[model samples]
Structure formats: C-alpha cells, structure tokens
Target: MDYGPWSLVVDAGLIGGLLLVGTLIRRWVGPAQRLMLPASVIAGFLGLLLGPRALGILPFADQLGTYASVLIAVVFACLGLGEDPHARTFGRSTAAFSAYSFAMYALQVGVGMVLAYALFVPVFGTPDGFGLLLFAGWAGGFGSAAAIGSVLGDAGWAGASSLAFTSATVGMLAGIVGGIAIANWGARRGHTDRLGRFEELPATLRTGLVPPGDREPTGIATTSASSIEPLGLQVCLVAVITVAGYGASEGIGLLFPSFSAPVFVLAFLAGLLVKGLARRTPAWQYCDQRTLKSISGVSTDVLIVCGIASITPSLVADYWVPLTLLFVTALALNLAMFRWIAPALMHGAWFEKSLFTWGWATGAVATSVALLRMVDPDLDSHTLEEFGLAYLPVAPLETASVAVTPLIVLTGLGWTIAVGWTAAGLVALVLPFVLGWTRTRRRPPDDRVEAAP
Candidate 1:
C-alpha cells in the first residue's frame, strides 16, 4: 500500500484507462456524441465519480489535488517555446481583441465580488473571497483555480480548492454546452454561414485521438544512434526549467512567507528565459514545436482529469446556492458581452470572433479554438490570427492578475481590490469607443468565408 513513486504509475495508468473509456463512450454513445463533449471532459467526470471523493472505487492518492498545480507549471513552461513573439503585427483588430479580453477579466472579477458581497455573504455566509472563484474558474480555468485556491486555503479559507474546482467544472461544461447551443442558434438564425453536422467530424477529433495517418513522428533524430534521443533531450530541457522554477518559487516563499508566488508564474518566466537563450544558440533548431505542443497537451489533459477527481463534493454542496448564483451571473454576463459588445469591438468576422471569445472566457483557449473550428473549419475567419497577436499584449497583465489577486484578497483588501478592478474593467470597456476601434464599416460578404470541407 505504500506505493510511493509507484503510486504515480498506477495513477497514470488509471488516467490512461479512463481516457480510453471516455473515447469509446464518446464514439459509441449517441448522447455524448450529440453533445460533442471532449473525451478529456468525460474522463474527468468519470474520475470525479470513481475517485475517493465520490464513489471511492479508485485508489487515488489524496495528493492528487497538488498534481494540477505542478502540471500547470509544466504547461506554462512550454508556452511559446519555439515561437517568435516579434513576428506578430498588431493593428485595430488586435487592439480591440486585447481590450475585450482584458475587459472580460475585469468584469468577471468585479461582478463576481459584488454579488458575493451583497448576496452570498448575507445569504450563504460565504468567505469574503468567495467571489473570486468566478474569475479563477471561468477566466483562468482549472490551473488558476488550483493555484489561487491553494493560496486561499493557506489563508484560512476552508474548502476553497474544492469550491474553485467545482466552479471550473461547471464553467467547462457551460462553455461547451453553451457554445454549441450558440453556434447552432447562429446557424439557424442565419448569423453563421457555415455550420457543419457534428456527426461528420472525424472520429479522431471527436475522441481526442490522433489517427495513424495524422500522427506525427514523436521526435527528430538529431542525435546519433548511440546518443540520447531528441525526445529525451526536449524532455530533459523542460524538466530543467521546471526544476529551476520550483527552486525559485521555494526561494521566494522562504523570503516572503506572506505572499508566495505561484509556481506556474515562475515557470512561465523561466520558459521565456530559456527560449531566449535557445534562440541565440544552435539548439534552437533542435527544439521541435510539435513535440512541445504534445507535451503541453498531455500535461493539460492529465491536469483536467486530476483536478476534477480532486473536487470535494460536500464543500460544493454546502455553498450550492451561492455557487449557482455566481455561475448564472457570470454566464449571463459573458453571453451578453458576446451578443452585443463583441460586434461593436471586432470588425471583420465579428460573430466568429465573438464566438471564440465566448468560448475562452467561459472555459479556456482550447475550448475557444474548438468552437472556432466548428464555425470556421478552414480558419479563414482570422479570429485565431488576431487573437494570437492580441495575446502578446494581454498575457502579461492577465498572468499578473492571476498571480496577485489571491495575495491581495489574503491581505483583507477584497473590497478595495474589487472596486479597483471594476474601475479598470470600465476603462477597458470604454477604450475601444474612445480610440475609434469600434466597427464603423460593415463586413463585406466575401469576409465571412464559408466553412471548407
């Protein structure tokens, strides 16, 4: 029973099995297919049901919750590893997209806090920081929720991690279901020009598996036959950065016991530093973008399953009313923004652009990309292109907020922080109009390219 490191193997095997089962279920089960749920989401729900928290069928370790935090760091460390940041050119679309993205973050936090203070505190007796779960779950996804929840848990907010995870789960479900509904509604209402039948999508996409023909080679044979493999080298490089990040975080924690920075924040900075160094060396050519993406993807899938399994259902049940209120309020606000605000901000392919934003605001980047693919299969809408450019400016501010918000709340400045963030949100909301970034010209018919086969 003292499995130690071997326990990791067992847990990983269980996760793999669950992924396989989820894929099969999605492939054969009519309802799951109809809803277009990802295999990872299904696997996560299964983990929640079978793990110790729910049915107790699986012998998962209590430390599974911590896995998300660490895996998230690994995920962040791989970001922009082989990409060029300076290549992107920002224009009106990028400016508008960046503003909208930041505005969403500010509005979610502001509205969430206000509701938590005025209603949840009086009605449910929730903690002062309860409102943060909205932004942590919806905007930051499971990773941010885990990191921020860990910080809150240390600050005497009992069951914060479980509540945040629960919120994340709800957000993911809402993003997928709501996104699909919206896409369908758009198609029905003649708002979207290209809407494909869900049944027609490839099985690999539906099941989240790479088919044989589509599977790229794992690594390039950069090394001699007797030397270490290229894949091993990449893995080692990532491990080195991750370890350095962990050490830095520990050092910071030791130096500032009051406000320990999240590991993912440090890891991201380390990644950028490593990438910068690599760019100046011969090794830059050896760094494969595809392999890095695969690593990040696997980390994310594992993180999602572990995060969902780690949720403490009883904690969620206790605050169901307030949690429900938070979820409804956030969902409504996001929908309204996409319906009205997005059109005014983004010019070309406005509906497609807004749809992508809706997906990301509710879930994560992957969810948004998936929804985008559904509406614009060929990616001709240029939402992804504009988002890529906009993210360069938006990422630093977003990450800073994610890392610092918990610390501010922990210092008992929740109300002041909420007001400041709300004001910032209002500014971001109005900046597009003031700067004349709002759409003035109508979109031409050719711009809304039909979805390609």
Candidate 2:
C-alpha cells in the first residue's frame, strides 16, 4: 500500500498501543517475567501477528525497516558523543579480554563465511552474502543487522533486510534463553552464589517496576527550563551531530559514488569530534551522560520493535534450512569459546569474564551485563571495567568489520577474507598464552562509557 508522511504517525500510534499491551501482559504473565523479555520484543511479535504479513489487522507503513535503519544512526550518535577521549590504561587482564573479544569478531565473521562457501553454497546454493548475516545479528544485535542489511540490500541482494532481522531476533532469543540456561548451569556448577531460580528473582526485576526506595532519576537537568529544556538541548546536540554525519556521508558518496558508507559510522565520527570540541568549553560541563543515554534508550526501543516487525516471514521460510544449519554451527562454536577457551586464558575471575564475553559474543553487551548481574551481582568481577578499557580497540574492529565485510565479500574474495579472519582469530586466541598477558587489574566499571545498542 502507498503511504505518505502521515504513515509515520500511524505506525508510531500502533507501536505505542502494542507497547502498552505488551507491558500489561508482562506484568500479569508469569512466563514472560521469568524470561526477562523486553517489552519491545513482545510488542514486535504482536506487530508481526497483526501486521500485513500475517493477520493484516493493523495497518503499518511500508518503511518499517527504513525507520529501524535510520534510528540506528541516532543510537550511534549518542554513543559517539559519550566517548572519553582521554588515554586509557590497559593491563594483561584487559589485554586478555581484548584478545578474546578480537577472536570473537574474527571467528564469527571468518567461520560464518567459511561455512557459507564450503557448506551452504555447495549444498543449498545460498549467495556469497549469506556469511554476513551471522555477525550482523549475533554480535551487533538489531543495529548491526540494520547497518549490514542496508549495505547488502543496496548491493542487489534481495531480502537481505528480512534475513538479517530474522537472524538478529533468533540470535537475541538464543542470547536470552540460552544465557539463562548457561547462567543456571554456572550457578549449579558453583560458578556463582547469587542465582537460586529465575522464579526467585526480585519482583521489581521481574515486573520491571522500581520501588520507591530504589527509584533513581533517569537524568539530571543539563540546561535550565527557562533557557531551553534539558532534553531539548540534548536532542539538539544529537541532531546537529546527525546532520553533520549525513553531510559527510553525502559528500563522500558524491565524491566516490561507488563507495557508500553507512551514516551511523560517520555520525559516530561526528559525535567524537563534537565531544572533543566541546571538552574545553563551559557547556561541556553541563553535558550529562545519563541525559544522552535516555535519548538513546528511547530510539533503541523503537528500533527494536520496528526491526522485528519489519521482517518478512516468507523470506525467512525460503532461507530456513541454511539459516538453521548456520545458527546451530555458530552456537556450538560459541559454546566452546564460553566453556573452554575463555577459562584457560583469563586469569582472576575467569568464570565471570568468560561469562561476560560469552554473553557479548552471542548477543551484545546488555546481555553480558544481565549475565554478570546474576554471576557477580556485586559488580566486583570488574569484567565490565576491563571490557571498557579493551573497548578502545575492540570497538573499532567491530565497526570496521561491519563497514568492510560487504566490500570484501562482494569483490568475490569471500573465501580469502574468511581464511584471513580465521587466521587472525586463531592468532589472537594464541597471543595471550605466548605473551603472558592473562593477569589484569580488577577495576570498577567506568561510567564514562555507554553500552547502548
């Protein structure tokens, strides 16, 4: 169906209604609370049920995927703005974690591509681009899916967005459900003392409600109401950064039409520049981290719902066989990384750090945080802190993968890149042992970083 500008409002209203219903169901339903499912996920499934692909009860815009694609840039802009430009101190533990993380990205990309060429393409006739769907969803979540999907789709890969979104939803499900199982396993095997049962979780956590004593403000006012709303100020700052990124992306496209970079990355670079420029200004003092996070939170939630709902079931049905094989293989390898590789190399708090990387490797950092809370509820493991230091280089590697994966794969050198990444992953895995950089300082999680998706 043809849609105009007003379609956005209609879509937003429908999403809002679904969100309300999703929240209510979570509050009343026992299983949902136990699963710790996000309201966005619930709402997205509802949308899928009611949307055109299924029941067609509620009308939605044709550009649901586009909404998700654009919102990701907004999310990244907040991330870029939150960067701490100061030099960081890294220790062996941090180095070990970094190496582990590097391996995660490399192997996921490498093995995925290797499987695509060696197994799927020969047997199922899947395209060369099939390899990218794994990391796009598993490692980066919906944001990475949107970023990578757009690139592949533009490169003439039909239905890439739907496949990417499906991969992400499935990956997230694995992360949450599988994570809970793994956490429980850890608890049973004497890895942690905090977890008794998911049922025994505090009501506030299960119900997503904050009691009066535990209530904390989302953010403090960064600007006076008289001058401008604090949130408005933040929105304005992010908007400027976004516009700057758009300009950069557009200029780059004009100069080199063959190369199209995602606006999110450019916006992220713009955010870093903005953050650095503002560092010395008096206005910088008023830039609260929490405020930016609140903005990011809103956009991230909306995109998750839109991304899932936008998936085309038919596209998924067509690719189910290969996707199933691919995901199963990836999960088995992930288990090895979690249960074996991480423990052997990591020093103090090996279980905690490995668990953190396991969660992140399968999904994103939020998943890592949830698992960590169950294992090291007291935040003593310093896994997050160490990851933060390691993030300095880790973040770039991930970003580069998303941007360059398609370029390399499209050039018909998919297998070569696969071998190279595999070798890189293997080398990273071995370096920790050879260099003896397994020990690390157990520091506190840094507030300067925002693990926003």
Candidate 1 deviation (Cα RMSD): 3.6
Q: Which RMSD values do the candidates have, in order?
A: 3.6, 5.4
Clashes of each: 0, 2
Error of 2 at 309 (Å): 0.3
Candidate lDDT (C-alpha), each: 0.80, 0.80
What TM-score would candidate 1 get against the native?
0.89
Error of 2 at 385 (Å): 3.2
Question: lDDT value for candidate 1?
Answer: 0.80
Q: Across residues 1-453, which tens digit of lDDT does each residue of candidate 2 receive?
A: 578768988999999898888888778888877767778889989998899888999898878778876888898899899946455887777788888888988898889999999888899998898988888889877778887887788778868888988888888888878888888777676655556455555556577666688888988897789999988888998988888888998899999998776788888889988888889798788888888998888888888888888888988999899999889977888888877776656667777777788777776677777777777766786888888777677777787788678778887988886898889899999998899874433322211111211
Candidate 1 contains a number of clashing pairs equal to 0
Model 1 lDDT tens row, 153-269: 767776888888888888988998899998887777666778867755665556556778887675565666578777777788788888888899899989988766767768878
